[model samples]
Target: MVSVGDDAPDFTAPLADGDVGSFTLSEHLEEAPIVLAFFPAAFTGTCTTEMCTFRDQMANFEDVGATVYGISIDTPFTLNEFREQNELNFGLLSDTNREVIDAYDISMDFADLGVRNVAKRAVFVVDGSGTVTYTWVSDDPGVEPDYDEVAEAADAASE
Candidate 1:
């Protein structure tokens, strides 16, 4: 996991949110806290649970003035289907090229373990200044993050 105060690599990736057309990261970076919830893949067990949890708690996060983003290595087509099926209310960014993951140094070349070139499941809380204030990467995908803790971290950092 990245330490607090590290600069989150600035990169623009394709995003599709509901009917919203494809856009870049800059479109959503202003005026609110950005929570990049990086999951391993779309439609997987832990990933689904984690994303749905974020979807459920989105309003609460917005009430506190935070914006959450769901990012994964899934193709845009898979991401679109997952978002529509789950009724996700946030931008699902496609890092299919793994550029963002590589830039952030979160990419794992786990070919030895039979899974290759997938990013680790992680959450990065980036402030308006684009500095990382909080980061949590699940060593094992089964262990989802405690949403409340992430919210608290965002709340505390925004103050």
Candidate 2:
């Protein structure tokens, strides 16, 4: 699993930010602190709430010049709908192949639902230099990250 102080793995994937585009981690390096919020799936109860919370707190992230993106195994098409429906302010990255999840070592299997290799609910705060400054991963998909702590970490990382 990716830990704090480790180099954040770089990957390029489809981004759903009102328009379909490509997001490369390396390209965004040195711009600002980046928040990568990985969730199992979109349009679900916990995922919706978590994403909406981030949307609500986007001003805090913006105040610190931090960029946030939500990631999931859902397709960009589905992610676009999810973003619009939830009024998410940040982009959603599509990891349809589970490459990002595997790279971050946050892959999980929802065997009860026959879903496999989905991203575990994880949050990684990466600074401008591509080093992880904070990380939160939950084995239980229902759990959400502490928004205040994440915001503080991003604020500190910006310095």
Instruction: Write one digit per residue (lDDT tens) for candidate 2, span 1-159.
Output: 999999999999999999999999999876669999999889999999999999999999999999999999999999999999988889999999999999999999989888899999999999988999999999999899999999999999999
Per-residue lDDT over 1-159 for candidate 1, one digit per residue giving the tens place of the 0 to 100 score:
467898777788778676435655555568457888988889989899999999999876787688898888888778889999998988888888998888777777556678766778888888877788899986676788889988987776566
TM-score of 1: 0.90
TM-score of each: 0.90, 0.98
Candidate 1's C-alpha lDDT? 0.81
lDDT of 2 at 158: 98
Q: Cα deviation in Å at residue 101, candidate 2? A: 0.3
Q: Model 2: number of clashes?
A: 0
Q: Which stretches of candidate 1 lie above 4 Å from their native place?
A: 19-23, 109-113
Q: In model 2, where do residues sit more than 4 Å from their true spots?
A: none
**Highest-scoring model, TM-score:** 2
